[model samples]
Target: MSIWEEHPLARRFWKEGRADFPIYDMHGHMGSLNTIHLARAEADQMVAHMRRIGVKHLVFSHHHALFEPSFRNVRAWEICRNHPDILRMYVAINPHYPDHIREDLALFDSWKPFAVGLKLLPDYHQVPLNDRRYEYALRFAAERKLPVLSHTWGGSSCNGYPQLAEVIHKYPGLIFFIAHALFGDWEGAERLVRESAGNVYLELTALPGERGLLERLTASVGSERLLYGTDLPWFDEYQVVGGVLSADITEQDMRNIFYANVERLLGRDW
Candidate 1:
């Protein structure tokens, strides 16, 4: 039998909606979008889904916070405050509005542990990840040693491997979560994790669908560097949870990817 065939966690998840495992999803988005329909995009619905799947916590940015220049992150803060047990938020930064970025940063500490870190979508915002406009946010995060989740892909100029490499080198103190694991470039993802001096993390948002990729990453960098995430509302929680549970890696590695690593990063209190 395959490893997961006999695994208790796997069997439990198959039977119950959840398992004994504690899942901490590091990447997710809330709210409906103009382009696509998100069935369970509301905060309450997302929290319910997290509970059903044994997710202990989720750190997410709202769709409006990322897409609407005027929406800012107040709504995200409010939602997180309402569901402090299950949700934390990333202060979304649109490099296009340096003033708004500054304002948000200035009030960042007020959000406390609820505003866990920052989120960057360079591709959607039409700027490179390492651009000057993002310097303030990067520097702020680096100074405070905050986790920054950035949407990344393989070949795009905005938040691709090259741009990510530059930012990683420039801000070694920042705990950078490379969302999507550079999408199509698995080799680059491995190399990036191998070369980093321990501050870079590969967040598995859209990556669990690529069979064997998780095992490859776990083998390459160990599970300490691999973070569990599902772009919830966009992706199914059980599908991604099943992906990790069924991987060839050990249960300890699965624990690290699911929650231990994130707990270490965000701390036990968070």
Candidate 2:
């Protein structure tokens, strides 16, 4: 066998000719990312991708929320409800609509167990991470003990990781997931996540085939603070999961990244 093929973790992962652990995709989208969109028939592609990849459950936000801030989350709730066995919803928030924010938070509170967390697309919406409008959502998340996943790039725009740093420090009790940090600025993401409180985490999605990005993230934050994500429908599911499986880390770390860490965040097994 080749050296990589002989590795113990590889053997276990591929012993049955597939991944050994149940995959819980922490990042996924249920709809199109556009002003105009297709119907549910097109969006079911996300469901098909999950089933094909053996993804047991996925946490997703509908792209409809990016534009239609008022009713998109309720639509997302319906999508998750329809696929209750395999899906959890992230209540999408747009800080631009302060009028709708309260009702949105109420909707999330009503969803309770079905609402896994909150999703903020500051990069798409161009809202600042430190914007006062986000406080209500953050406070609701803190009260509910739910995680808040936000779009984070590298530079110092309102949506950048630097701006998120301010929010992270302000609410140490809230768990923050830095989505797409891998594809943004790996070094800056690593530094920010490493320096912040343990409540901050980085989700591995939309990542390049860099030699040591995963290893460096594991080293900086350890496995418990890292999550696996596919950004499904936007990217191939197997490709994203395989990136973590191929990382040069121990089996325990692999287990954590693949399932355990997100399970801990969700407070239950999938």
**CA-lDDT, candidates in order:** 0.89, 0.75
Q: Which pairs clash inside model 1?
A: none
Q: Residue 136 in model 2: shift from native, Å?
A: 1.1
Q: How close to the true structure is residue 168 of candidate 1, measured as C-alpha lDDT? A: 93
Q: Which stretches of candidate 2 lie over 4 Å from their true place?
A: 8-17, 35-43
Provide the TM-score for each candidate, comma-separated.
0.96, 0.89
Tens-digit lDDT track of model 1 for 107-199: 899997789899999999989998999999999999999999999999989988899999998898999999999988878888888888899
lDDT of 1: 0.89
Please write out the lDDT profile of model 2 over residues 86-202, one tens digit for every residue: 888788889888767787787776675568899988877887888888889998887777888888777748767668778888888888888877355777777777777788888
Lowest summed lDDT window (length 10), candidate 2 = 34-43
